[model samples]
Target: QQQVKQSPQSLIVQKGGIPIINCAYENTAFDYFPWYQQFPGKGPALLIAIRPDVSEKKEGRFTISFNKSAKQFSLHIMDSQPGDSATYFCAASNSGYSTLTFGKGTMLLVSP
Candidate 1:
């Protein structure tokens, strides 16, 4: 597993808006970058991810923008909604391991 770190601990955004969260990793060997969305009283599930070779990746209202050169990446939540209010975690890991190193955590509050 790689040591990944994220910031802002929490975020507040308006409904139908976008909220951006940043993360950085120290290991250059890490090849997998994944973002996870977690609701209250639940475990985090995969949201989006990008490999080191890719500059950006998106799925639905979730997007993962990666900067391999900078060993950094971020998650962008588009059209944020009250239902989207939850904790987001940016994670990284190398091959051969199922374990992920997550950041402290970010709680996103989408106000209706």
Candidate 2:
């Protein structure tokens, strides 16, 4: 199992609304869960991550909810804003090389 899949190719959120994206994987061997945020024409930067040992992880307006048993995970964006409109990617990897297997990507558009 070495694949992580994400859905909702794109999303739209109001300035103060919350946007949620879903992801699922088949690999139980994966230990690192990382969500990356990317602006137009830029590389994605690590937003937040959680290990399999943790059930959930949160940072600033970004939160990652994980379910080890189901091999599923999700990203929640709180207080979504125009500046937050960007491409978000979900990735997973085992404890070895930091080579991340990334999702297709989800484009989030936060409007005023």
Candidate 3:
């Protein structure tokens, strides 16, 4: 199974602070990258993502920064709020089959 190493198993931030979660993978065949945000008692929802062709991508308050050379990527939640507290996951998959390998997960707590 492909593995994505994610840092900072957990994090805490004050309101309005940006919480960044980083992930690294060794596989180069992986082409599609995406981040998922899961709230308590709910399924994960796609946050933001970037392809190898793009250095970065942003959707609303969420941002994804990608580095093809390093085979790494990160997720940043801008202006984090208490309501934003949840578990974030980073995933990668090649175009073929769309099988995704996700990071263990990161628990984020945003304090008001």
TM-score-better candidate, 2 vs 3? 3
Ranking by lDDT: 3, 2, 1
**In angstroms, what RMSD does candidate 3 have relative to the true structure?**
0.9
lDDT of each prediction vs. the true structure? 0.88, 0.91, 0.92
- How close is every model to the real structure, measured as TM-score? 0.93, 0.94, 0.96
lDDT-better candidate, 1 vs 2 = 2
Q: For model 3, what is the alpha-carbon lDDT of residue 30?
A: 93
Task: Give the winner by lDDT.
Answer: 3
Tell me the tens digit of each residue's lDDT in model 2 across 32-112: 889999999898998999998888888898989999999999999889889999999999988865778999999999999
The TM-score of candidate 3 is 0.96
Candidates in order: C-alpha RMSD to true structure? 1.5, 1.2, 0.9
Give the alpha carbon lDDT tens digit for every residue of 1-112 in model 1.
Answer: 4577898898998999999999999988788988888988888998888888879898998888898888889998888889999999988888977777889899999999
Clashing pairs in 2: none
- Using lDDT as the yardstick, the better of models 1 and 3 is 3
lDDT preference between candidates 2 and 3, better one: 3
Instruction: Name the weakest run of 10 consecutive residues (lDDT summed) in model 1.
Output: 1-10
